[model samples]
Structure formats: structure tokens, C-alpha cells
Target: MYAPQEDTELLAGALVEEPVPPGADVLDVGTGSGALAVTAARRGSRVTAVDVSWRAVCATRLNALRAGVPVRVRQGNLFDPVRGRSFDLILANPPYVPAPDGRGRPRGAARAWDAGGDGRLVLDRICREAPALLRPGGVVLLVQSALSGPEQTLGRLRTAGMKAAVTRRRRIAFGPVLRDREVWLRERGLLPAADNEEELVVVRAELPV
Candidate 1:
């Protein structure tokens, strides 16, 4: 639901540069709408897109067909469907909304967009498990928000034994998630009425060879 041009552009640029090299395997975790996976497939990577939502998985399949790219779309949580498999590159736009009480998400797409109590649940899991799924010299590209603590995400990657860096960042207008959270925070006096800025952070990390 928070799909944006910056997300698409970042994936496009990464694929254009062939970050995984030719004939490498790539994984698009949380491939909502299949944008990154499809783009990577078009660039000749053997791509697999994974999502927990059946609707998302179906949408990705339909989108791949429309794009004429043979991307493998799987319905599973995170890396569950591809256990024991490793990829040369991994890309993710995980749900990072901080839902302290787990009430911020709608029932249908909660798994797709909710990150548990602190909004870092999915991200933390990804960081913890990604190293095992990455091939030697493999890289992981993750996009998250400042609301989720950009520095903390980077730190998680480093703690997971990956060489991490913030590859790109941009000031994004308040979307629905942010707007809703702002309202909630405002009601509790946690956020001031004058603050309305949001930032998106894109991080790239490499698994050691």
C-alpha cells in the first residue's frame, strides 16, 4: 500500500547495474506487487519472490506474466519456502510500521505490513536469518523508514556479520501508515503537531565471502 517511485527506482537501478552479476540467483523477500523481483528477472537473474499473503503471491504471478518475465512466486513467510537455498542477492521492503500494540494493521494485510510490537520484528528476523541464505559475496538490499530507527537497522545487519551501509535515502511525504501513526502519537502527546517529515532509508549489505 505504501508503494512509491523511490522504491521502484532503487530496485531498477540496482538491477541495471547487475549487482548480483550474470546468471546469479536472487531473492525478493516480501515482494509486494512483485516490483523488485520482476525487475531483477528482466535483468536476467533467476529470481524468486516470496510473500506471506496469498493475494500478494497471486498478484506477483500475474504481474510477472504481464511483464513476460519468468519469476518464481512463492507463498510463504520470509525465507520459509526457500530453506537451505542461498541467493547471490537479496532485496526486501519489509513491513516496518511500529505497531506497539499490534493494533495498527488491518486483519487482511497485517502480516504483509505489520512488524509486530516495535515494527522491527520482521526486520530483525531478516537480519538474523539472511546471512545463512546468502551466498559468498552476496549482497542484501533493504529499504526501511526512519520511524523504524535507521541506525538500529544498520546495526542489526552489522551484528549479523554483514558489511552494511546506507546506500540511499530520501525525504518522503507522510503516507497512510505514517499519517495514522502521527495521529495516534499526537493523541498521546508523543508527537508534536508541527512535525511532519518522514525519511526513507535504503541500505545495502554484503555477506562475507
Candidate 2:
């Protein structure tokens, strides 16, 4: 319904620092409001943007028009429409909030933030699937909450044959969703008994030519 939050901004900040070559081919997974897609286009990279939500696709299209940046927008699960294609750079700010089991992949407001307990449902798949879509010497900039286990993301990307690391991290007070789930998050050992902040991390995974 709206653009993403601090996590998205943090990833955008981190991405602005990467060395994207001129005319680089870039993919923005979960393009949402097309913020990062616009950024990539503005930086002179050819951009392709994707999201599973119809609203997000429309938002991305509108945002791109407003920004005067051309973005190839598609509605599909992560990487599906782009299968068999590789890119010089990829960006994602996926859902990483830990939620209860049996809560199937959401389709409404919660779809933008809710992931299964442990918060790796989408993250793990990204680690497993993204490396294959990177051209040599390419990179994927992924952002997630530390509660989802950045180490796990790092390890999985490395195992998938990419060098991955946390390049940026910031802690912020719980948003409304997290605040609402505080009790369950605490019970699941995700949030500390006395802690009210969550850390967001940008994971940079790269392939060597």
C-alpha cells in the first residue's frame, strides 16, 4: 500500500555506494514502490523490477512514470519472470518479520512484512536462488532483519558460491507490526525480554569474474 521503511532506505544507502558499471543490467526484486528501481535507472543502469503484489506492480509503474525513469515491471514471485536471465546487479528488500506457523504466505497488508517464524522463509530462498542469477563479477544487495539470522544468509550465499557479508546494519524501535507481535516474538526467543529494538542488515553477496 505504501513504500517500505528504514530497512529499504538502508539498502538504498548501501547500494548507492556499490560500483555499478555504466550500462549495467540491474534487477530489483520486490520492486515495491520502485524506489530502488528508480535509483538504479537514475544511476544509468538498465533496470528490471518485479513484485508479487498487484498493488506493488502498479505502484512501481506509477512511481517510475513520476520519476521519469524507465523500468521493466513484472508481477511474479521473486525471480520467476526473470528465470534464465542473469544480471550485473540485483536488489531486494524482502519481508523478514518473524511470524507464527500455519500463517501461510500472506496476500494483504501483512504480505509486505510477515515471514514465517525465524524470518527466513523468503531470505533463505533468495540466498539459494539469487547467486544463480548473477553474471560474473555481479552483485546482489539484500536487506533483512538480523533476527532472521544474517549469519545464516551469509553462510547460505557462500555455500551457493558467492562471497557474502553484512555491509550495513541499523537498529530501530519495533514498528507497529513487530510491536503487535512482541509477545510472540519474545516467546520465540527472537526478541530479548528487555529489548524493544530490531537490527536491520544489508547483505552484499558478490560473484567474481
Candidate 3:
């Protein structure tokens, strides 16, 4: 399971700023450790956290219990376990790293990162499906590396008829994963040859009332 990192904290900060009404239905997609889910629960929202890894689901459940919060945790791919359901708010901190060629579908813990060549393997799907899961006036707060193309996410959400914009951004130095893939990323023009930092962005898209 993926642990909370800079991306997770960035998304969590955005969640804190959001106005969540008591009893609001909140979905924490790709919830690795249930951090965001618990945060919402603490605010009086009914939280449901989903993660593809069963381990992650268990961790979230345990964490919520330890925190004295109620979080309905599920194990499944994004939005699969909650099909036909809508939420007042959705949070995602998906895999946004651009993986090299010959890397097939991520297995085990690698699923937390290792997105496809352009790094939109999971991101594109979220853009297409998340809007449908959002109720009227609902919002989606997604954090991803700029290397994956934040503009692409913004365009896709707007195309889906949501009011979308980048609400937060941060420049963090390349972590071990990115540092190892530095050569490939530079070759793909996803990163600058001289730059050692990657910009993380939180995109907020809202369904109109």
C-alpha cells in the first residue's frame, strides 16, 4: 500500500479548505491509508474509502477505528465498488508517475504508482468517470504530478461539463521513484534536463447545481 506523501498531504490540505456539510456523503477514491476519509469523517461527513489493494482497505479500516471515526472502507478499483452511487465530494491521489516502456500493468505495491508512458493510465479514467459519480454541486479534488499533464485533466473535466481549475500547486524535488526514471522522463520531454523538481497540482472540478 502507498503511504501518505507530499501528494497526499497536498490533497488533504485542499480537503480541509473545502466546505463539507455535516452528514455529507464523501468518497475517498484510491484511499491508501484512509487519511482523507478519516478527515472527512471527523468533519461529520459520512465517509466511504475505496482502494484496489485489500491491504489498503484493511489499513484504512484500522486507522479509522483507531481514530474514533466511522469510515466504510471497500476494496476495488476506482469507483467499481461504489457503482451507481453519487457523492457530495470525491478525493483521489492516484498514480501519476510516468513509467518506462515494457512496464505492463502494475502488480502488487507498484500499483500505487507506475502509471503508463504518459502517466495518464489512471488519471484519464478518473476524469471520464468521476463526473458521473458526483452529485449536483458536488466536487472532485485530485492531486497529480504536473508531469502527467495537469492541463489534460483540466480539459477533460471541463469537457465533461464541470467547472474545473487548478486550485493548488507545489514544486517538490524528485523522489526516489522519479529520480530513478529521470533519464526516460527527460527523453519523453516530461521533465526538463536541468530541472530536479516536479510540480504537483490539485485540480478541483465541480458539478453544476
Which has the greatest lDDT? 3
- TM-score against native, each model: 0.89, 0.97, 0.99
The collision pairs in model 1 are none
For model 1, how does the per-residue alpha-carbon lDDT over 1-209 read when each residue is reduced to its tens digit? 23435655765565566455667899998888898888888888899999888878888999899999999999888899999999999988888766657465435755655676566888898888998999889998888766677788789889989899887777767766667677775665534577687677788889888
Model 2 weakest lDDT span, ten residues long:
103-112
Model 1 score (lDDT): 0.79
Q: Model 1: what TM-score?
A: 0.89
Q: What number of clashing residue pairs does each candidate have, in the order they appear?
A: 0, 0, 0
Candidate 1 residue 200 C-alpha distance from true site, Å: 0.4
Query: How well does model 3 score by local distance difference test?
Result: 0.95
Pairwise TM-score winner, candidates 1 and 3 = 3
Predicted candidate 3 versus true structure: per-residue lDDT over 1-209, tens digit per residue:
98899999999999999998999999999999999999999999999999999999999999999999999999998999999999999999999999998989989888999899999999999999999999999999999999999999999999999999999999998899998989989999989877889999999999999
Worst lDDT 10-window in candidate 3: 187-196
**lDDT: worst 10-residue window of model 1:** 1-10
* Tens digits of lDDT, candidate 2, 1-209: 55669988999998899999879999999888889999999999999999998999999999899999889999999999999999999999988989888888776877788888888889888998998999999999999997888999999999988988899989998889888889988899888897878999999999988
